[model samples]
Target chain A: MGTGTGLGRVRGLGSAKKGAHHWWMQRLTAAGNLLLVSWFVISLVRLPNLSHAVVTDWLSSPLVAIAAIILVANVFWHLRLGLQVVLEDYVHNEASKLGLLVLLNFYAIGAAAVAIFSIAKIAFGSAA
Target chain B: MSRNHSRPLSPHLSHWKWGANMLVSILHRMTGVGLATVGGLLFAGWFFAAASGEESYACFLGLLTVESGAINIVGAILGIGLTWAFFTHLFNGLRHFVMDAGAGYELQTNRHWAIAVVAGGIIATLVLWGWLLWPAIMGLVGGEG
Candidate 1:
């Protein structure tokens, strides 16, 4: 059920060393997202209510917190990689491209950190 | 490569017949970018509000639905739109996974599956939303006491 092995077979353009690595990670994260996000949404829909207590209690569970953290990590990683390709595709100026890539990295890392920290805080009952 | 004056230029979309697969490809990219930006920011807001305390969490929830005066319309639209976008990316990504497996490559198969991805996303979004909001929808029809 891996995406990279199949994509790797069709890598005429993405066959370069770094390209292959990037391509592989993208597929890995994509697969991770498919599973993790499905879990997230299904659980969300099943929640009796989205009240603070209910949500906090849910996050307080070790398994939920751990999965949330991993989901955030994988999501942001996939996002950064995918957006990198888009920026590299549309924004051709060397300076602009480099600047944007840096900005993208910062955004992905910063946002993921904030979300993960928030989830951890809830998991620890600090936000209660 | 040399350019020739008044010669036929490189053909683009206008020169080719439009197909469902083409739309599917474009939509997959669009939905990916949209889901990442809009869905990511919205999720960040929800998580931050949750971590900030109950008051913040309630405020966020209020704004998300019709309970508050703030951003309800925008929030409601985004709720459904992001759901659709998310489903679109999910189905289309699945389509890629199948293609990666060296199946569904026939012209008709490709086009039908492309159409299926598009249609499947819409159907799934509707189904999920319909189920979740069934009570609210029923209430609107005075089905609730």
Candidate 2:
């Protein structure tokens, strides 16, 4: 598992070039998730209450909104990349793997859009 | 660009004895999925509820909170599990960061790191839940005693 062989070694096909890029992105997003999620949890716990007004007010801050945007973006990207690996590894059927991968992309984008839209509505709108 | 039908496949799970490292790998994937599905819904729901208005917000909270007024106890359970998943994923993710950097690859060291990931993730999850519930617990104890 640690080493490669034959044509793959010569051509750098599977785990050499493109795979390296995926690996890098995963690590990059992992680091981002680590920092942003910490900020998210801390900010959440520190809130005086979880009421609508309180939460909206908290998210209205420019800094919090920015951090949240980054958090959402990184999380979804990391999740898509991670799930891609899972599907690739376990899904032997080519058609099913491709369909699932497409669905995964759409799901991540769609979900993140909703969350980001909600955050934007709070941050840009008049303080609640 | 030729596929090799005769090429050997990757080793099956049964080939190796189960270890924490394997568990960590599986947990990372499971928790990742759980967070994206359950946690993402909660994340979006909270924000959307807040933006929608007080009524909608209250409706959402009714599903999320632990009060008697809660519409669904399962939501609360899912929320708690989401928190644990988040923390565990986070801690284990950091351990993965070290591994990604091309460190801690030795057999013994890898196992040790895997144990740390599991222990640390669980401990972190417990500590967070404890902190969150401590106030409520104190109120209950105070009322009783």
Candidate 3:
């Protein structure tokens, strides 16, 4: 009884082979976002005000600087994941969906890179 | 027994997969709600800082950090809730992308992944809080000396 047939036996049976990779990526991003968001909130809370000097000073700290960079990157990456699903669900046209996905990834990656780079320059350039 | 179109019995929740896809769907909604709220708060913070002088900004800061106060309480609640929303959404969102790629549809594997996500979220939150609060703790200790 156990030695069943061919393809029919596997139809809608078990694991979706690729699902674990998605699961793992989601978990990884979640973990990263958790750390980044917490740091961002606390840092924002501690900041004195909108004063340019104060804002710069807050951002100048090595810890805050690095965290900010990470936070921005994580945020964009997370946003990409979210918007991808929204696009997939709503945009029926295959071309449009694929285009949106590509645009989202490009925008996220570019924005994150810029944010990280700018923060790094501001935080470290003065010293050098 | 002619045709009856009322509906079949609902499956037990416990027996349901409650797996990656389900988890991701739920988290997307949760995070959307959270992000909306947080976005408002964020803009408000900026507005307050811009409008009032340094003193007012300081007051806002004090309200957030001061112990045993309404503002602090609200801050704490938002902090935890937002953290959960962010982590859950991020993790589950990634899961959705992977599913789009056609993966992880196994029953047993899905269950394990769901459990892992929840556990991972909790642990990550704790670690983040610890890192963020360490400086404040050190400041308090130094002040006492």
Error of 3 at B26 (Å): 6.1
Which model, 1 or 3, shows the larger TM-score? 1
Q: Give DockQ: model 1.
A: 0.59
Highest DockQ, which number?
2
Best model per lDDT: 1
Which candidate model has the greater lDDT, 2 or 3? 2
- Candidate 2 residue lDDT tens string, A7-91: 5556643444475798889889988988898888888889887777788888888999899988988988888888888899889
- Per-model TM values vs. the true structure: 0.86, 0.86, 0.47
The better-scoring model by TM-score among 1 and 2 is 1
Q: Which stretches of candidate 3 lie over 4 Å from their true place?
A: A1-18, B1-27, B30-145
Residues B5-94 of candidate 1: C-alpha lDDT, one tens digit per residue: 778878877878889999998898888889888888788778889999999988788877666333367776888889998999999888
- Tens digits of lDDT, candidate 3, B1-145: 1224596766765779655546655667667546534643443353334234456556665655564322366667777677776666656656655666688778786666676666667777778776666766777789642
In terms of lDDT, model 3 sits at 0.62
Per-model DockQ against the true two-chain complex: 0.59, 0.65, 0.05
**Model 3 CA lDDT for position A42:** 67
For candidate 2, what is the TM-score?
0.86
